[model samples]
Target chain A: MRVLITSGGTTERIDDVRGISNFATGSLGKITAEQFLQAGHEVFLLASETAILPEAAENLTIIHITTTDSLVKNMEKLVPEVDAVVHTMAVSDYQPVFMTALSNFSDDFSKDDLLHFSAEKVRKISSNSDFQLMLLKKTPKVISYIKKWNPQVQLFGFKLLAGVSEQELVDVAQKSLVKNQADFIIANDLENITKTQHEALLISFDRIVKMHTKLEIAQSILEKAQEAYHG
Target chain B: MRVLITSGGTTERIDDVRGISNFATGSLGKITAEQFLQAGHEVFLLASETAILPEAAENLTIIHITTTDSLVKNMEKLVPEVDAVVHTMAVSDYQPVFMTALSNFSDDFSKDDLLHFSAEKVRKISSNSDFQLMLLKKTPKVISYIKKWNPQVQLFGFKLLAGVSEQELVDVAQKSLVKNQADFIIANDLENITKTQHEALLISFDRIVKMHTKLEIAQSILEKAQEAYHG
Candidate 1:
């Protein structure tokens, strides 16, 4: 089977010099990609430019992505060719419309005076700037577009929630799985994640498999995806 | 001589999971620190947690910091003890006050509705958000405060500017150097920097040294600081 695995976090440009990015390191995705390659599967690793990567191999193709725009383009290009997608990339929720420097955070500030001229890209707002406002527009749902792009491709979605109950995380994961028409959902608790531990619940439509470590999770995911592809 | 070095890019939190950061990799700083260490200097490296770091050594003390607040705190504590400071860290200019979900980016919005409650770290906004406006107040000038922290400490500052003339870059760096009371400022062009090349001008009050590579830049900076310390 061919797999397109995404890892790490997407960054939305605030300007040529600055950006907003999430905190996904793509370590697990790198590990998962390795497991697939060991099983002799063709792997297209769609990863953040800053993500941890599996070593280059004959069966492994790496596509480094940055913003949500780049991610959309790459996923659209690869989703049709691959048999499955393990999307671990934490894609940004918003894209910048414009950024304006503010004088203060005072309540008396006028909305008409808000935009303050968004730059082309240079954002030469001087190193001497004080206060600012950034207007971010919601990006399209990147995951939902996967099934729409390739309905037959199996999808394994990962959801990270912090300070939430076990049941709540799973329920949210379940809903997301159904909504996205995914074959599996990995419900991850942010609180439980550390350098050593990455406890997660692998939920299918009918079953839940518990994973305690990143290695365990990677092996299980690789196996489950293989089972579905061959079954 | 004892030298304090700041490296990488500081992150300003938008929420618990999301943040705004700059593009510095801390690669140059790491290279510079190694040069200093090879020259038998005691190095105090205050770095962004995400930065590329020098390997641990008995003479090297590493302090990993995240936000602008942490950077300020660390600089204040370490400045008085060190003989010189090489500040290469890309600190954030603004910090988030609060974020509100916008139905749309229409100008019909009200400033009265501008500040949605600043969450206590856990930003539990639904994943189904449409739009958001983040108000960011300017952080205090970190470099200016450094000299105030320790009046006698020789300072080597790094300034990055994109899409600007060489003269403009130097002029700004010169102003920053004078304003911050830095002994030397490395004026860097964003366009000239790549994996192999790192064109920079090391500017002091009366002299400028041109450097064309990261290693060359590192060597020059180390020598200049050593000269100042010995003189």
Candidate 2:
């Protein structure tokens, strides 16, 4: 199978020195990619800056991504060919509409105030669009694009919640499934996810199964892919 | 207040190359620690061996931990003085029953003839109690120790669930509140955690509030801590 996976949290720069990113280390997407490779499937990976690189695979292609626009651009080209795409990266949902020209960035600033004239400052600077404080726009939901780009390709998306119960997860997962047209959504318990090792529940349309380890989850996904392919 | 927070999953070695771990990346614990520090609390952190560091804190002590025994040992000593203890690390619930002695690990050639070992020989070699599969004893519950060590100190714990509804989360959180005697339990959805960047909810005894960013969650925690301190 031609499997494509995205990992890591995209950073939206508030300024040159600071930005917004997610609380992630990129272990899931990295390991999931490796697991797919181990199962003898071709893999394509688009990684944000902060995600850890999984062990190199002989049949895997890696793409470095920094913004939602770039991601959309790459997916425009790659999503058509792959059999499955696992959308794991936390894309910055809000970004600045544009960036300042490089020349406007100062090496040394004057302590005293300088005269300013107001002219409309607008342009497409997708570079630092990930993090902006005041004038930000809701990013294109990548999953929406996947469904639009390739109707036949199997697409999976992730959802997270804090302090909701098991029944709440199923409701949310089901909603996400129908809303995004995802084949399956892996519902997780946050306490176990961020603190240490915990189990995960795979919620599909008809059934739910608990998997205790990442390997177990990956293997199940691989088997599901095989089923999807053979039929 | 002085505090200690542990984050991330510990790898329990089963052999030279294999070990057991979980999907957790240590974000929540780290975020909490950052919030506590932001509130001007002195913090000490015991972190699992992973690539990510604990959130930056001005008043913080960091201890790298590997085994369940070591975690208990460290806490037994430190739990006495801190005003609050947040045990967030996903310590392995089990460990290898035995360790193989290096001298006994011989790989001499035996392909030419049938490989055989007498029952007595096998028993003799395997009976070393220290090297015998070390049956893992469950680690002491951190809250139990906290309550025991300092009855007056405020205590908190988390209960995470997957594939459950919001009502289930509240039910689970309430049960945990009574059973664990926790001052508060931040019940949460896991599938929505590591990947979802913006949405988080907090469940206390009387209410559930959804927060849009990690910063807001930290702010809520700080407010709760202050309320507890003042009340």
Candidate 3:
């Protein structure tokens, strides 16, 4: 079966030289993809440029992407073809809108008084003035469209919260799962996670399974996905 | 002699998870540090978190840092203690100043209409608005302070320019050398660089040497620095 796994953090470029990225290393994604590959599945890993990649294999195909738009484009094209998709990538919530020079930044600073420029045109933005204004807009949700793209494909959506309570986390994840029509939601807490131990909840339609390690999480997803896919 | 090497690209944080970083991987810095260590010299490597680092050794000490302010603090503390310094880290030119929400973004968005907040005070920014305004300010030059911190330490400053003529590149490198009072300046062009090969010009008091590889650059810096120090 063909498996699609989006791993790592997406980058939002401020310019050609500089960009904003999250803390995701894609190691967990690597493990998930490897588990599927080991179980005789064809895995396609859509990874960030800075992500920790798994070893190259005959069955594993890697596609490197930077920005959110590229991710959306790839997802829209690849979701219908794959049998299952584990959306683990930390997609950026926002993209740069426009940049302008704030020459006289005060109570009277208005859009009419601003001179905005496209960040793409400038290779390296010069920080010559008192304040260089950068405007950002929300990016589209990549996971929400997975079921719409292919309703038959089994989907696992990841929800990471900084410091929310267990009930709050599960409720939010459940809402996300319903809205996206995903089969499973991996609810993760940032505070309890460390290098050696990962605190995550495998939330399904009726029950929530607690996972203590990254390997366990990968194994659970692999086992559960195949079981549901066949039966 | 104790040699100080600043390698890698510094990350400027917009928040806890998201940050801006450059393209420098610190491979050249790693090579340079390795060269100094092989010659039986004490090496202090001040590197960014995302930088490629040299292998561990008895004489090699690594210092990891992020942001311009942290880099400055490290530089001030280490520059006075070392005998020679090779400044190669791609320091961020700008830092985040303030972030404001642009609710009714149009031809008449004003500062008073803005609700500005500190990025550090918030966990994750909600992109539910039309536009989020991020203001940035110029970062202090760490190279400019090396000499002022310790006038006796020999300095080598790196100047990276994108798609400029050789003469233009050299002229800019010379200007930077004079401004920083660096003993040597390495001029680099963005267009002529590749993963396998690097194009660099080593400019000294009276002449310039062209280098085709990262090894050549490291060797040139090592030989030149030692010769000047002992002679």
Candidate 4:
């Protein structure tokens, strides 16, 4: 089987020098990719440039990406060719609508005054700390596009919820599974994910499988993918 | 001499699960702290927990901090005891005003509807991809408080600019010096800092000293601190 895995957090550029990104280390995704390759699957790792990855392997190919847009573009090109995709990238949902120079305004300026300034005026900001305003815009849902691009590919989506109960986590994961038409969704909460060992729930239409540790989760995902492929 | 150094980028929490932060590896600050310890200065490292640090030394003490408020609190306690302070932490200038669950809103909602929703209402969001809005509020400048807390400590502030000319970098550094009453400001642009070897301009009231490489920058800073203490 050929597997496409995405790890790390997507970064949205606010300006030439700065960006908005999440705190995904890509550790789990990298682990998953390596596990699949160890199981004799060819792997294409679409990863954030900041993510720490394993050393090169004969069956592994790495594609480094920076932003959500770039990730989408690469997925469009790669998903069709792969047998399965495990998308664990912490894609940013919002981006700065406009970036203003921190040096353009004084400390005393009101929010109204700041909001009134157009993106055109904000682009001229030159100084680092000129007191600026950045309005955030919602990014399109990338996972929702995966099945659209490749209906035959086995898709495993991820749902990360902070401070949520197990029931809530499963509910959210189910919604994602239905909405994205994913074969399964891996759901976990913040409290467990931050610990050395974590647990995740794998939800498909027929059953929910709970697995402890990242390794177990990855293995279970592969098992399900194999079942789907051989069935 | 007693040296107080701050490293890593401060993180501002958006909700129970997410945060906004800058891309500071704390490599430079960690190197500077190591250099100071090697030079026999008693060191207090108030650093972000995310930063990588040198191994423990008898002359060094580490205090982990996360947010700007935490950093400020630690500074208040440690600044008076140190002879010099090197503030290299990339403190966030803004924090999200509201954090709502992503499950509450539908995908079809308009931007105007989200904008009109009060923070109180938006706080009720539940799902992960429910399309949400986050408002950003300016954070108080932490550097401006250094002199007010300790009048005698030699303060070294850092100014990082991206895609700026050398002249612009120096101007921002000078402004920081005057405004914050810093003894010196180390100025560097993104283009140079991203390279294997980088240059920084040390801007003081009397002179501007240019140094190459992270080690040279750290050494120049300590040298200036020695001049301020003994001269």
Best by DockQ: 3
- Of the two candidates 2 and 4, the one with more favorable TM-score, higher being better, is 4
Q: Lowest-lDDT window of 10 residues in candidate 3 chain B?
A: B111-120
Q: Model 2's lDDT to the true fold?
A: 0.62
lDDT of 1 at A144: 92
- Minimal lDDT window, size 10, model 4 chain B: B121-130
Give a tens-digit lDDT track for model 3, residues A196-222: 999999998898999998999999999
Against the native complex, each candidate's DockQ, computed on alpha carbons, is 0.51, 0.01, 0.58, 0.17
Error of 2 at A13 (Å): 2.3
Structure candidate 3, residue pairs in collision: none
Q: What's the best-to-worst order under lDDT?
A: 3, 1, 4, 2
For residues B1-231, what per-residue lDDT tens digits would candidate 1 score against the true structure? 899999998998887778888878999889989999999999999887678999999899999988999999988899999998999899888888866665433455444455443444455445566557777778887989888989989888888887789999889889988898988999997888889999999999998999999999899988888888889
Instruction: Put down candidate 1 lDDT per residue, A1-231, tens digits, no spaces.
Output: 999999999999987777989878889989999999999999999888778999989999998898999999999999999899998889888888777755444445444545454444555445455556777778878899999999989999988887899999889999999899999999988788899999999999999999999999999889998898998
Q: What is the TM-score of each candidate against the true structure?
A: 0.91, 0.45, 0.90, 0.81
Q: What clash pairs does model 4 have? A: A102-A129, A102-A130, A102-A131, A103-A130, B101-B125, B102-B127, B103-B126, B103-B127
What is the C-alpha interface RMSD of model 2? 27.0
Fill in the DockQ of model 3. Answer: 0.58
Ranking by DockQ: 3, 1, 4, 2
Name the lDDT value of residue A133 in candidate 1.
70
Native interface contact recovery, all models: 0.68, 0.00, 0.78, 0.14
lDDT of 4 at B31: 90
lDDT, residue A222, candidate 1: 92
The interface root mean square deviation of candidate 4 comes to 8.8
- Least accurate stretch of 10 residues (summed lDDT) in model 2 chain B? B111-120
